[model samples]
Target chain A: MKRELTCIGCPMGCRLTAEFNGTEVTEVTGNGCAVGARYAREELTNPKRMVTALVRVVGMERPLSVKTEAPIEKRLVFDCLAALGAVAVAPPVRIGDVILENVLGTGVNVVATEDIGG
Target chain B: MNMKTKRVDLLIIGGGPAGLAAACAAREAGVTNLLILEREDALGGILRQCIHNGFGLHTFQEELTGPEYAARYIARVQELGIPYECGAMVISLSPERRAVYVSRTEGIVAVEAGAVILAMGCRERPRGALGTPGWRCAGIFTAGTAQKLVNLEGRMPGKRVVILGSGDIGLIMARRMTFSGAKVLACVEIMPYSSGLKRNIVQCLDDYGIPLLFNHTVVDIHGRERLTGVTIAEVDGKKRPIPGTEQEIACDTLLLSVGLIPENELSAMAGVALSPATGGPVVDETLATNVPGIFSCGNVLHVHDLVDFVSAEAARAGEMAARFLSGEKTAGERIPLIAGNGVSALVPEVLSKRPEADVTFMFRPRAVYRNARIAVFRGGKQLAVKRARILAPGEMAEITVKQDAFCESEGELTVSVEEVGA
Candidate 1:
């Protein structure tokens, strides 16, 4: 099987292609640098990305921005979003505070990305 | 060989918003001996290609085009009489913060400085990264490069086009193509939501009658010598193209507006440690990288979504770089930077150990939110919190860590967010 992916490891976003036989990748091509190849191999097998978004905040005109406490498995991004929907936050907020304690059994918490005024 | 190298108080690289701001700030900080180096004959980085308005909303409190926004800084730099080298490409950078350059007139020279600022900016993602099956043809170009060709070079790309990725550049190009007598067939995006701001979707596409295909991606390209057409597919929950759903769109060109990546070859060669999250060097509040005398700012640190924010961030780095050179800041101790929930990345990748000043960290959210709470923590203790309104993937959020918070802390500093009210 042949597959192509953008390297999420860095913003270089190296558009990479991998030739895979079953689960093993045979060849990788089309990156500006070497790290692109490494990213293709690693991500093609096990992809992961930092999940960021927002959760509801108290006493504000809009939602409080949020993201994963840590980079979860790439396959779990949507699932994480679903879990995030069930969570809520309070106002008098601070930057770097976690909104959800443990999200979606991933052990990764969802935290705030911005600050809310009291 | 007697190599007579000039030691300056400050040396700045890449002559963009960050370099200009750094030069100005360094001068203000009392470092009169300064020099800025630019690779291009012009000073602006990506701003030169951006012809449409909508910049400077935050920093300048007015909407301006890329060139117009850049002109403000360029004029300021000029008014300050800051010395700069144009058409000078930096060949290498030393870990000790020395800048090496080469030009047509000047064969080679090294500028040793008390402090150095890296502001090379970013590059666009290309077709190779997207894995779209197609012939490598002439009609394919990154949106920014195409913009430069048309807006700056006085040339047209093609008559009809298909654009991949709903980034700001792609959206802007959609409008630009229409204005330049070309018809944009459609704008396709793999993600369900656009990566560009809400206003761009309305002004660039909606106002122009360009169709936007969400959850769609270009699966194949058809062309021999030039672009002729492309096959687009609808993506499922996993964002994989659905078989049999491919539709071929006839066109002469493909414009990729996927994303931007920080240009860090010089930083990498200089041995500056970079954050995997941002793909840029980690620095402290002073914008100084781990290598004490070396500093960084602007798109070179991270791919900023807005040019206005880039200038503001770069100004901070410049001020810090000037302080470093003037003996106002001495290396004390440094700490690690931590990212919490709903945060994709952080700047000033590292923290200072004996931090005497505050540090501002920038990051992106996970998805759209109605009400969210952003908070900072250290050693399992909450440090500060702020409320947010309507956060999206297209926008970047900034948070500041007070100097008082770092005064007695010794562990990892974390930034996170939570949803408050629905």
Candidate 2:
């Protein structure tokens, strides 16, 4: 099977072609750089994306912004958001404070990216 | 009934990425008494709400979210002990660099600064700007407002959304709303090509199987109290709605991400000359407005597509502001930097004759061009040329002219794009 993808590695946005055989070994072409090639391979195998969401904060009118330390599996993105939808933390929250630990057993922690104080 | 007065070597407006970076750079360049006024309750203006990743790639050489990118600079500012006041709204600024502001803690404070840097960024073009035939609906929100509501307030604006304009913010929101379990019906753009980056078009819309309708616009809106749906129609080349091409997509919310306009009311109050093309301040090479001792950078100078570029440009503005404060000599005899064929707008509207250093000109093209050559001309003579594989209006392009090339050339520097093998 062949799939055409746009490499988001950089602003260049190179159009890439990926050749796969039953989700097996393949060749990737049309990438502008090595990073684009690696991105294409990883995308075909196990696509990952960094997840950002808001966690409810007490004593504050607005919620605190949080994100995963690393990119999680693409398939688990909505699930992770669903998990975060139920979570809330209290302020005096500092940046990098862990909000959800080992989210969905993915071993990725969602940490606060903003400081919200009471 | 005496008002308080404070003096600083430099006063920066807006404490977002541009202002923070400018403050740090100015301080490092030997300006000690620097004050930043931010209207927000905290630092990191818009970045505080932009939690999505894909920022700071050019500056940090790594992928970072908006807040993460902002935190890096916020930490630096704190470490440098740069004095900044949050919740301080600058009310007026004079041509003499005198500023009056009001805050909850400080009532009616004034500041006299040796140099002023206007970093007050851009704001989204609201629904009123488009004049869509619709009632004053409650569910219709600007994309940035929705972003703030979703990412900052932890509130979902609506369950079903129809986004107008495929700008980056709108494209990102389409995916964001989808991830939040909201059904995004369609993203409509009146322009044939998207005004967003290609990566956003792919990662945000294409990844989720969301439909992107080009050359289409929402002509009419339906809703009495809240948004019920929007009538989208295909537009001709002149952007006129084609009859019999109207389609109604039922959705409770409508998000507009049409465009961003530089917030330059403060700049105007300072008597800075404005650029009608850029909708910002007209600036020289050092990002200095025609108003002496006043400099502008970031989105306040021109709407920038990337925050990384905003930081880079504001850093230059900070350094220049420092030089102005310290009585350093600068280039003389300004020359106009003209945007010619296929170019829409150019920053630093004029170039200063810096004999020792090269000057970079940043501009956006009028449309998408493949295999194009960006040529710089002076006195009708070609000075330099840079080949580009592709150029798009969404992405800003830059080209540097060596000091030797510039020093030898005369007259206004005109930059234009030519199609290769055309």
Candidate 3:
């Protein structure tokens, strides 16, 4: 199988073609750098994405924004949002405060992105 | 009726990243009295609702979310003891450097300042600006508004969405809406190329498997009361929709991210001349406007692609205001700047030849040029030239010319791009 896509590794945006055989990427071409080859291999198999979302704050008019400590499985984004939708935190929350420990067992903790005063 | 009045050495409008950075810089520059007025209830401006990361890379050398980036400046403003008022909207500004404002606490207040900095940022071009044939309905919203609704209010805009433009904000929101369980049918752009950054296109749309249809636009908006669907069509070179190319998609919301316009009504009220191309104030190298005591920066001066640039520009504007108030600002000959070719909406329309101040000419390219040379000319004579691998209209390009490269004699300076071997 052949997959064509733009490289997110850098601004150069080298259009890449990845030839894979049953989940094993064989060769990557049209890359300006080594980073593109690695990106194609990782994307063809296991893909991850940084998740940024909002969580409800208990008794507050606005929600608190949060992000995954690291990129999680791409397919787990909506699941993470669903997880965040049900959880609420108390006031005096500071940025970098952990909201969810190991969200959906992805091992990526959801951390707050903003500070909210009580 | 008499209103509460006060005087300050420098008064900054809008307490966003621009105003906050400017106030800190001005205070550090030894400006004794300075104040910032923000119409919003908070100090961060639109950054308050921008929860996604990828900001502050240039300014802090770190990737931070919008609020985190704004917090850095807000903290500096506090430590420096710069005064600011929230919900204080400057209603009018006069050429005399007097400003009238209204706030919930200070019903009416007037301020006179030695100098002023206009930091009011830009606003999104609305549906009315697009001239799209659509009924005034409830389901339509500007992309930023939808972003605010999702990020700040934590409320979804709709279950199914159709975004009209490929601006960065719209691209970001497309991913945001998808995370919230909304099905974004398509991202339609009237132009053949996307104005958003390459990184965003890869992560925001491609990662989610969303289709980005270039050279297409919404021809007809369906469902009168609430948005039920929209008919999109491909456009010709002139951007006119071709007949028989219309395809209808069912969606509950239409998000318009067509473009952004600088909020310069107050600048115009103060009699500041605006550049027709940028829809912002015309200023010199120091970001000082035609009016001696007034300066402009950030989006009010010109729409910037990044907030880090806005903060950097605003910091300089603050320093310029400090120089203006110090009674030490030297009078310099004004050299006019022209966008010669392959460039549009070049900023700092004029150059102020301060002995130590080198200026960078920033502009948008008319089209894509690879392996191009940006040339700076003074009276038909080339003064400086810079090389770039690629330049595109989607990205802002710049060339820095040293102060000594220019002659003492005043000459019309022009900035243009030339494709190598063209």
Q: lDDT tens digits, residues B325-388, model 1?
A: 6577466777776788888877665666766777667788877654788888899877678887
DockQ of each: 0.01, 0.58, 0.63
Name the lDDT of candidate 1: 0.77
The TM-score that candidate 3 achieves is: 0.96
Give lDDT tens digits, candidate 2, residues B300-330.
8888888999999989899999999999766
Clashing pairs in 3: none
Q: Which ten residues in a row have the lowest lDDT in candidate 2 chain B?
A: B351-360
The parts of candidate 3 lying over 4 Å away from their true place are A9-12, A21-26, A33-35, B353-355, B408-410
- Scored against the native two-chain complex, candidate 2 gets a DockQ of 0.58
Give me the candidate number with maximum DockQ: 3
Model 1 lDDT tens row, A74-104: 6676677667656667786664577887777
Which candidate do you rate higher for lDDT, 1 or 3?
3
True contacts kept of each: 0.00, 0.66, 0.62
What is the Å distance of residue B25 in model 2 from its true position? 0.6
By TM-score: ranked, best first: 3, 2, 1
Best by TM-score: 3
